[model samples]
Target: MNLFRLDASILPTTSTSAEIADTVEAEWAAAHPGATVTRRHLGTDPLPADAWALAATGGFAPEQDRTEAQREALGLATELAGELERADAVVLAVPLYNYGVSQHFKTWADLVIAAAGPTASLLKDTPTVLVTTLGGGYGPGTPREGWDHSTPYMERILRDAWQADLTVIKRELTLAGTNPAMAALRDLADEQHLRALTAARTAGRALAG
Candidate 1:
């Protein structure tokens, strides 16, 4: 089995999303033993911001008439799409930044669409897990209840657009322990953290099984 793991955490060491993804990956690793795990760290090595535009425009141009840059961009787009097609499973650890998906993830998604076409289900029926975390609460009645604009968009892409057999794991209020203003929420944050961790292990086992 081959697993494709994508991480968009700028702060890898302290990323709550990554912490959960690690558990899922660990279980997959243990189950597969010698199976392959392809990894991409978009935060540290972001894709060229212009690649998606180049790839999209290049598609309209004849192959022989495509510019060198266009050719390279298309190649990268193809590779990104191919990764999804080749994987038996997928893990995407994405966090909310400014209440939306980060640029790294946006670029990656654009590239994939550039290669696979907007309607293509590259991960059709593939078991995929998306781990997303937020620093503040966004549940009903919370001040930011509707402010979270990341998770739903990704759900549209991964579950609806990509057609993956997707599972989502989420955690919020991650800053309660460190942010002075959120001190009152520390206890609740702790509870949420443990629940997220437990959910991670369960998701991992399900992925492996």
Candidate 2:
């Protein structure tokens, strides 16, 4: 079986999102020994910022008239879409950045749309695990309750758009352990961490099965 894992954390070494994803992956690997895992790290090797525009426009241009850049962009879009299309399962490790999606991750999503069409279900019926982290609490009643603009948007794309059998594992107050201002919430953060890890294992077992 082939599993696709995508990570979008600028800080890999200290990334809670990645840590949660690792738990999920470990469970899958244990269940299916020797299974192939394809990994793409958008934070370390981001797509070209302008590729989406070129690819989006390229789709309208006749193949013969497309410029070299547009041709390359379109190819890249197809490749990104194919990675998702071919995966038996998927794991995405993304974190809230500035209260929204990271630009690079956004670019990647745009490229997938450009290649697969806005409504294409590239992962139709496929199992997908989405692991997202937040530095602060944004649940209802929190000061930033409505400030999280990343999760809903992603769920729209992954669950609604792509039609994946989606499972989301989200954790908040991730900065409590590191940020002095959030010192009082460290216990809550640890609890969230454990919960996320447990969810990952459950999700991973589902993927393996």
Candidate 3:
């Protein structure tokens, strides 16, 4: 079995999403001993800003007529799609940035779409776990309810577009103890954190199966 894991946290060591993903990956590794893992660290090595656009344009052009830039972009798309096509499972460690998806993650998604072409379903039926973290709470009944623009978009792209067997694990209130405004909710944050970690472990085991 092969696993494709993408990490989109800017802060490698200080990232909760990465930590949760680590647990999930560990479980997957345990379940499938000797399984190969393909890692892409998008946080530290972002995709080229124009890769998606170039790739999209190249798709409509003849192979011989494509520009060097377009060729490069298409090559990247091909590589990224190849990784997904080979993986039995996928893990995405994403942290909400500015209340929305991280730019790096979004760019990678664009490349996937371009690489897969219009009719090819490269990720169809693949099991995928999304480990998402939010510094602030956005659950229903919270003051910032409906403020999270990332999760829904992810659902649309990963589950709807890619047709993957998807499971989402969210860790919220990440800034409660550290942010002055959220100090009062520190206890609640800790509780939520523990729950999230437990869920991560559970999710990891699921991946292995």
* lDDT of candidate 1 over 135-171, digit per residue (tens): 9999999988999999999999999999999999999
TM-score of each: 0.98, 0.99, 0.96
Q: What is the C-alpha lDDT profile of model 3 across 7-72, one tens digit per residue?
A: 999999899998889999988898898879999999999999999999999999999999999999
Ranking by TM-score: 2, 1, 3
Task: State the lDDT at 28 in candidate 2.
Answer: 88
> Cα miss at 57, model 2 (Å)?
0.7
Count of residue pairs whose backbone atoms collide, per candidate:
0, 0, 0
Which RMSD values do the candidates have, in order?
0.8, 0.7, 1.1
The TM-score of predicted model 3 comes to 0.96
Worst 10 residues of 1 by lDDT: 200-209
Q: What is the total number of backbone clashes in candidate 3?
A: 0
Candidate 2 Cα deviation (angstroms), residue 1: 0.7
Give the higher-TM-score candidate: 1 or 3: 1
- What's the CA error at residue 124 for candidate 1, in Å? 0.9
